[model samples]
Target: MVSRAHPHGDDDIRLLGDDSFEQSDEKDNLISFDDTSGLRHRGPSSSHKKPLSAARSVSPSSAQDSPKGPVVAVFVVVFDAKQGNRIEWSHTVDGSVDIGGVEYKALPSGAHTVSSDSLTFKIGSYYGVAYFRTETDKSSARGAVFRSCGLLGRRLEDIVGFRTVLQSELSQGKHSTGDYHVLEDLVGGRSDFVDNAFTPVMERVNKSEIELMHDNKIVRDFCTLLGADIFRLWKCVLLRKRILILGTPPFADLCHIAHLCSLIGNYDISSPLRPDYNLLLYVDLNDIDKLRQSKTFVACTSELIYQLKNDCYDVLIMKNQLHIQDPALQRTCLTSAMEKENFSELMHDYNLRSSIMHVDSGRFDATEFVGGYFTALNEKILSAFHAADCTAEQTIADSALEDLSLNPASDVPFLQALANMHCPSIRVQRQPLCPQCHLC
Candidate 1:
């Protein structure tokens, strides 16, 4: 017969041994019943059959006696973008369960079911589940099954959109080739028959050959325009086409020349061209004192100027008091010089104002320094326009032209008008202009 002992004040009951069944402990409260034959006894009647083992006993602790439920194993999948694949699933549990022949312990007791899609687990008794999605599956297919379960609305789509946009923007533009019709006209003294003179000699020059030829032409023109003798030396150094400048030595001016070459080459006038030619500058000299305070300063500048000339660059040297006669050419050089300084504070504060004032005051021809500075400024202006964004190019060109216009002695107001209509500007300058056309 099954015997149960009740806790004095608790709902739980303890099962006692057959000997203890006859006497109730003060801590236990026992109730005895008669056998089915109807014979009464102090304990369970001997005639009554014992309860089946599974149901015979009750423990004082309900936790020990209650039937434990099945545990559900949950797998949470995570998509890994860097690896371009789906990573392994993370497992959780509603209760303990065996997975892949290994026992997982201490899961919350509940009815459990493995996910047919293999990426989820449902704890039926607890009404809980876990799920995840993979990156590849999310990208290629709209959605895929995970252990027979639908995996939808499980991943982020914004990242894909951003990447697509970025790639499209990066691959949209073409390379630059320096080609400017106006500059060619100015240099050759007439626009009537110059196109044929600059036409490609070969039907299709390879990219490298085109670059080399363009670089050589840029150096030659720059030196000649500056009235320097560097172009002759450049012809001699055909074997060493590349030139490296060790000090600052006005890099912005060279970049301007490069931009002019691009214009002449008919590069996309609307976009900034990536630099293709190599011109390395080393600014990190180990000796700080050797920079501007040494006797080597003047020597270094002279040597650099000589080398630049030898390399076929138009290297014009000016005493602080030199001047020039042609107003148009002077204006162009002034713009180029401004560009060479990369629009630095020094250019804006001193060179640009001084050049403009000299040209306006009709004092440019009085000093070689004024003439040289003007030439450099013109080159710098052209390069800046080339580097500006599509929308800002026209605006910047107009502003530059206006600056030139303020100087009555300057002679390129018509060209400035054309620039204002067609050129692009730096992207940052795309905000709407004021009624006065001022960039607000």
Candidate 2:
């Protein structure tokens, strides 16, 4: 579950089966790495993909579905110096056609000082990517192909292994001899694409459809949530801004809870409109403006802390009183019994100290873990900013909401309690003391 913030950059370079970019280039090199043994998944869903009739030419006429053929679909993503995911490009290539011959080489790669344009993979052939980079300019790109792990006689790992080799062998200049695989020997030029040998079925991709289709697969799926599985990833994100409440048994009342929060005039977790102020921030899904503008929220994560680390966020790091599972694993490592109680009070204290904003995590019962924080902030947000805005915007928003508008019952027991207090602030604060001896 290593995040973009991995501490060992040099080590990553080495592990990616490449030496320092500063090393001299070799005329022919090879690094044979097959991760099929490491693959944990065993199936692919093919019901949605359209099948291609032939492997040589991609048929674009299957307009009802995304392009599908014998070729693998390669997705490209560029990263920053710290290796954070950035811009992306997607293309389709037959396994025998070579990733470079498809389309991307004619674009930004030639313009930028591409450090290395190589292929890497995750979980056998379920995912295959062609990575390219420009070190001096801090530009990087990747081409990814997706197929069911076991579909159309394609064993997941076998496809990944084949595609990786194709992308490598297709490089015009032979890779230098090193601690790497000499892929050129295995590759045959475009002429070898005939005879239906080592070909793939992939559909053509157009520029207009790329964003709605591949951006998430590259940016969010591959880049930010790499170590995490997609199921929980969807849940953590489905309710983007709200303090997402999740439980191990899948929280049967998720929608109901959201409804309740809305009725109480609290924020809705699943609402689509972007928040003026966000409380949960996904690594690649969010931008810099959202992070800097956030208030009260400190970096509070009980899970996947490493994934979010060292990406150059300058906010205060609040102390977490509890620990939880990494979000990438399919299931939570912790059970409900171990969950901390009175979480609300702790969140309130943390917010008072940090002036909080957003929270993002994939731990089991994530909502419960941060429920206290959300609850405390719920009142504070309503009482402070929302109260005024709601009243002002109600007239213009809708006539339906006018009947069910905000009405803060000014007379409450808490008001009497605060009025009876002698402090200038509305909330009453007591000095911290040891409960056992009643002294600090």
With candidate 1 superimposed using the best TM-score fit, by how many Å does residue 165's alpha carbon deviate from the native? 41
Superpose all Cα atoms of candidate 2 onto the true structure and report the RMSD in Å to 1 decimal.
19.7
Q: Supply candidate 2's per-residue lDDT for 115.
A: 39
lDDT values, one for every candidate: 0.24, 0.24
lDDT of 1: 0.24
Global Cα RMSD, each model? 41.9, 19.7
True-structure RMSD for candidate 1: 41.9
TM-score for all models, in order of appearance: 0.17, 0.21
Model 2, position 188, has a per-residue lDDT of: 24
- Lowest lDDT 10-mer window, candidate 2? 45-54
Per-residue alpha-carbon lDDT of candidate 2 for residues 197-302, written as tens digits (9 for 90 to 100):
3433221222233332222122211211122222222222222322322111001121122222222222333222322222221111122343444331112221
Q: For residues 337-416, could you state the per-residue lDDT of candidate 1 as single tens digits?
A: 32223223322333344356557853211112222333333334445555453342334433444343222222233234
